[model samples]
Target: MIPTVVWGTGNVGRAAIRAVDAHPKLQLAAVLVHQPAKVGRDAGELAGLDRSLGVSATDDVGAVLAAGHRAVVYAASGDVRPDEALADVVRAVRAGAVVVSPALYPLYDHRNAPAEFRDPVRAAVEEGGGSLFASGVDPGWGNDVLPLLVSGLGSVVDGIRCQEIFDYSTYEQEESVRYLVGMGQPMDYVPPMLIESVPTMVWGGQVRMMARALGVELDGIRETLERRPLESTVRTRTMGEFAAGTQGAVRFEVQGIVGGEPRIVIEHVTRIHPSCAPDWPVPPDGSGAHRVIVEGRPRIEVTVEASDEGENRSAGGNATAVGRLVGAIDWLVEAEPGLYDALDVPLRPAVGRLGRNQKEEERA
Candidate 1:
């Protein structure tokens, strides 16, 4: 079994622990946490599992990597500390641990990523003979794999569009939801994410990845943004009341222009309250959906709705991201040492998990 370490214990990291424990071929070596309180805690307990896994959590990243684990799931947040996250992943790679993460946005398309971000990772991979795979829900699969796969259904596809429509009221990341996304901020206050060129910086890789897969050359990339104000104050259990006229909803698109048209688009319709954007597209049943629309002869549209831990879609999205990242570890360990994009990694089937339930029943 491949010995693996999971770093960070937030939304993504928590799910990573559970995923690693359940994987048949991967053994939970150790878990690394940033919080002092989380240190020395059992992996299972940190992940909110019913029972404790033998492994414990630590903060000594250098020592953990030095132990020579075969794989590292870097589940730390990169939004606030991109440079630090990159350095941490580089250290893991240099230690010869195949690293899979959803953190580094720039490295999602390493080939097209800027030299500053790509060079260090490449050097680390070369130095230690390790590999890296970066991915997430929206930039990860919603725009890259899902759209490209769905486009195949059309004989004459004219355009491809991927969307993330979600209500953020249940999302647990209070700082990001309230500050980074400007949920409670006045309309005049610009959220960092909606700043000029930021959308392109974040989601453009997915656009390019899809365009490349479709054998289309993008003329350029473009961005569009629209925000709405709360009609009335609404209180939440986690976050307090969002005052009237505050930023309640945002809709934006990163368009990959092909033939002078926005042929490939990555759109996000995010709302702090469901009632804020009644006109905008919403999930069919719940609070969130990752949708892929192929606008062509057949006009195909597929919606993916996921919920976890008391119908929380944000947690559900994070869990799916963990699934993609963790699921690729075994394959990455056996492959050549280098940075791999989403398209480079095949989404392998759950071969071993097919009979897992039956086996559990037998054991019981």
Candidate 2:
């Protein structure tokens, strides 16, 4: 069994702990936390498991590394000193442990990443004889892998676009709302300059990855950002006074090259409020709708209606991302060394079904 340590006690971290607990080939060795309040607490309890795994959360990084684990999952907030978090991962890797993270900034278009991080991280993993991989639902799977999969259906493809539309009122994380969707700003307030660069940051590698897969070089890339107010009061667990119409929406676009010319375009749109969708050419698919449009010799459009399993749509996406990550721990640990995105990671349908089985057993 692969002994694994998990960092953070937040939503994604807790979910990862639960996944480690149920994984057949993986064991929850230790839990790391930065918050003093959570230190020494049972990992199971933190994840609402109501059972102890004989492992407690600790704030000591060196002590956790010395515990003889082979892997660590870093699920903490990227906005909070990502460099420090990267250092922690590096330390774990130096101690001979592979690392997987869901942090946002690290995977934002590899071109924009500082060489200081890219080189050191790779060297650390190699020095320790371990590897590193990063992935999440949005840039990880939704935009990158999903589009690549859609392209498989056709031989000649002109362009590919992926869209994720859902109501953010149901979202509970303040950082997620503020950073990913640009919440708390006026409708007229344009998204931050960094927000406009997300497509290049998150999926820029996707453009490159696809370019390599399709044997084409991108001529140039383009991006745009826009926002509008909400039309109705929305309820959420975190905020009670969202007002009748107070929210913002943001969009990102990337056009890729073919034959030394621009031929493919990819777009990502996010809205924090209702009616914020109407202002855009393509309105929000409020029902957790995801669409992939392929324009080529054999034109095709595929739409998927994601399950509304949770109280709100945003929660459902979070849950899906968390669940999938947790379920894949066993397979992920065995993956070969070097950087890997979602496309590089294969999903084992049987492993996913195990999660479904566990959920069913819990409900029963």
**Cα deviation of 289 in candidate 1 (Å)?**
0.7
**lDDT by residue for model 1 over 70-184, one digit each (tens)?**
9999999888789999999999999999999998988888889999999999999889998899986553777788788889988999999899998888888898898887899
User: Least lDDT summed over 10 consecutive residues: which range in candidate 2?
Assistant: 104-113
**Clashing pairs in model 1?**
none
TM-score of each: 0.97, 0.83
Tell me the whole-model lDDT of each prediction, alpha carbons only: 0.88, 0.65
Model 2: how far residue 61 lies from native, Å = 1.8
TM-score of 2: 0.83
Q: Local error of candidate 1 at 120, Å?
A: 0.3
Specify the highest-TM-score model's number.
1
Query: Alpha carbon lDDT of residue 117, candidate 2?
Result: 71
Candidate 2 per-residue lDDT, tens place, 1-364, comes to 6888888877668767876767666678889998999988999788877677778899998888887688787878665467787787677777777777777454534444568777777787687766666665552556566677788899888877766766565666776676445565555444443456655665566666666666776666666555556666555556444544455555656667666555555566665555666655443455455667878868778765544324455545655565566655666567766655555667566553444555335545
Q: Which candidate wins on lDDT?
A: 1
